[model samples]
Target: IPTIKLNNGREMPVEGYGCWKINYDRVWSLGSWLFNDDNRAGQVVLQAIRAGYRYIDSAYFYNVEKGVGHALRYAFRTGIVKREDMFIATKIWNNFHRRDRVVEGIRRSLRDMGLDYVDLAIIHWPMGFEDGDDVFPMYWNLSNVPREWSRNGFVETWQGMTDALDMGLAKSIGVSNFNIKQLKVLMDSSKIKPVVNQVECNPYYNQNKMLEFCQQNNIVMTAYSPLRQGYDLLDDPNLRRIARRHNKTAAQVALRWNIQRGVAVIPKSERRRRMNENINVFDFELRDDEMKAIDLLRQMPKLLTFGTTRSHPDYPFHDSY
Candidate 1:
């Protein structure tokens, strides 16, 4: 796996296994945790690690940290990888944006994962939801009604992230789903700049300007949905042409496109075959024209807008970036 040097001089794996949408079955109706001993999620994580994945991207919102933790423990005990050998990155959820909750959030994730510290602990989203146990506090018990937003700004949350760093809870800190404008505000107000800005990026919704901005600011750009979940980016003619030329899958072409642009990617897959394919992009390279051909797909509509939170004051996608 290629590595990207963070602003803090930490080297992060260019490609990682994302843990989003894992163990959703445990999240009964999105209301509570079942707390069963089903380690299916951990087994998949272990499989990913066994397939040469070193970076594991997770978050409190994922609700599978315990399973992921079990896999990490099994790997460590069985000599698959040491704690320092893997780069584990989790996020502070929106409800945990308060300064105090920021520290608590990471601690919770650490506790769930059975780790003392994480390589990277990022703000999951710039917008904060109402602080409470519920990830999404509903309004008037109506699921479709507008969710409550927190008054606390991310600047305050970043301060807590800095606290997490000061206390050695995380090796590096970052923000996710933040636009260039929001990043500027946070950078201006905070003492330590975020090392990364993770967002949805792929051939379809290529974040060209955002990537340039983050690169200019010395921040690493990471793509969460690098493959555009549920959408077949592999069906695109340009990507298929490039994939055939290299005898690679279109998914490989998409991931390679991001890697070639110096953007780190965290593509998720429950199946081991797809997991192996996602990380097998190191052998081939994309030419300039091929990269441009993939870039043309940026005209397509973005896959994830998180439009439910659009009314929030700090919603990021409202900006052009």
Candidate 2:
């Protein structure tokens, strides 16, 4: 796998596994019940490790920290991968954005994951939500509450994030779901600038201007949803034509295109074959023309903008990129 040097001089794998939208059937069902079913989630993590995936992305919002932790401990005990070889990344959810609770939130995640520290810890979203809806145990619903209620708290929360790095609970810290303006606020107020910004990036939502901004600022950009929520880019005419021309899978072609642009990608899958296939983009390269063709596809918009939801009052869409 290729590597990108972060602003703090830490090296990160260019392509990793994302464990978002993972459902643990026993613990969660169609309605409001919580149970325990760690088998499938545990197996997926182990399979990812066995398939040579060194980087793993998890979040408190995912509600599978214990399962992830159990799987990691099992993998290490079974000699699947060494501690130094793995890069584990998790996030701080919105409700814990209060200044006092920020560090505690991270500590809780570490406790849940059974790890002392994580490679990268991110503030999950720039905005915070009220904690009542039970979307995830830690998730607060922002569906109706406006952004103004949480903006100040969000900044305070970031200060606590910086403090986490100072105290050594997280090696490197950053933000996710932040737009240009939110990032600017962080840059201005922070003692340490965020080393990375993870956001939704794919052929449909290429985020060219955002990418350029982060690149110019020396902040690493990690592309989540690289396959567009499995919307069948693999069978799409343009991507498939490009894939055939380059002798690659559409997924590989998409990942390779992002890699060439110096963007990190986290494409998720539960199938062992797809897990291996997602990481096999190191050999092939995309030409300039093919890259441009992918770029043209970005003109068609897809996916929700991070802060543009009706619930966020200060959505940065009008003011910033």
Give the clash count for each candidate: 0, 1
Error of 2 at 135 (Å): 6.1
Rate residue 135 of model 1 by lDDT: 84
Q: Which ten residues in a row are the worst by lDDT in model 1?
A: 143-152
TM-score of each: 0.94, 0.90
Model 2 TM-score is: 0.90
Predictions in order: lDDT? 0.88, 0.80
Number of colliding residue pairs in model 2: 1
lDDT of 2 at 7: 95
Off by over 4 Å in 1: 27-30, 33-38, 141-152
- Clash pairs, candidate 1, are none
For 226-289, candidate 1 gives per-residue lDDT tens digits of 9998487778888888899999999999999999999999999998899999999999999999
Taking the tens digit of each residue's C-alpha lDDT, what string does model 2 give over 1-321?
668999999999998889885544544332355665766677788888899889999888777777788889998898878788889999987667767677888898899888989999998876665443343332155343432454545677788898898888899998887888788888888768898999888887798989999999999999999888777666678888988887888888988989999999999999899999999999888889999999998354546565324456445455436
